[model samples]
Target: MLMERYMRVSQAYDKQVYTEDGIYLGKVEEALIQDNSRIYGWQVRLENPKIKEALRGKGIIVPHTLVRAIGDIMIIARVSIKKEE
Candidate 1:
């Protein structure tokens, strides 16, 4: 489940990001916030072997909608994140 209240954007930095399936993707590099001050997405540095191999060093952008929960770590929908070329 999602958090019950708001969170400071700075708190997300360095938080480990992982897939719901438990694949360690990377750490939080930045958070994309809209002009309205809402978190729109997350910019995660590539770290996982498989995901990095396919993504080719490019950072991962996970939309807020794909985020299942937020707290100690970030969990995203892996299937959709692996948008292979």
Candidate 2:
């Protein structure tokens, strides 16, 4: 699904998604938007301690371009930091 379609249905504090080799990462604390209009990505809150231990933080931003799918939940193409650089 397109990010714009997701923006129409989803809201803040909704679950954000993460994946690496098809594994789930965590849920979202907030959804980020572009120009205050469509969703640009999200602010994901890490749930697993293993992930927390790895990230050394509570949350991170994800971009809409990285989104692979949106079904029962939001799906990201890969697991990563907020930005590339």
Candidate 3:
């Protein structure tokens, strides 16, 4: 089942993530997609309001590929900006 497969992929990933956590952080400015490899993940751009509000001034970019499923809820791979670039 496609849905099942997607669920598995999503469940395998998608976890809680925080920026600096100590101060006002930023928002997702942009996303850098990693297409060279088949892995799932992306690099997020942190700037402006996104940065000001970000705990770490680091935005999160979830790869569309990692998003194995998007049904009642949007699902994605458990990825981190630290692990992206």
Candidate 3 local Cα displacement, residue 41, angstroms: 8.7
Alpha-carbon TM-score of each model against the true structure: 0.82, 0.70, 0.29
User: Cα RMSDs of all predictions?
Assistant: 3.3, 4.2, 8.4
lDDT per prediction? 0.82, 0.65, 0.40
Return the TM-score for candidate 2, rounded to 2 decimals: 0.70
Model 1 lDDT on a 0 to 1 scale: 0.82
- Report the number of clashing residue pairs per model: 0, 1, 16
Worst lDDT window (10 residues) for model 2? 3-12
Write model 2 residue lDDT over 1-85, tens digit each, in one string.
5445534435535564658456556786666778977777677777767766777887767787787776556677664555212
Give per-residue lDDT, candidate 2, residue 34.
Answer: 80
Model 2 segments beyond 4 Å from truth? 1-12, 83-85
Give the winner by TM-score: 1 or 2: 1
Model 3 lDDT at residue 80: 32
Q: Write down the lDDT that model 3 would get.
A: 0.40
Instruction: Give me the runs in candidate 3 sitting further than 4 Å from their true place.
Output: 1-55, 80-85
Please name the candidate that would achieve the greatest TM-score relative to the true structure.
1
lDDT of 1 by residue, 1-85 (tens): 7645878889989899988999898888888889976888888888788778877866778888899878899888876484322
The true-versus-predicted C-alpha distance at residue 55 of model 3, in Å, is 6.5
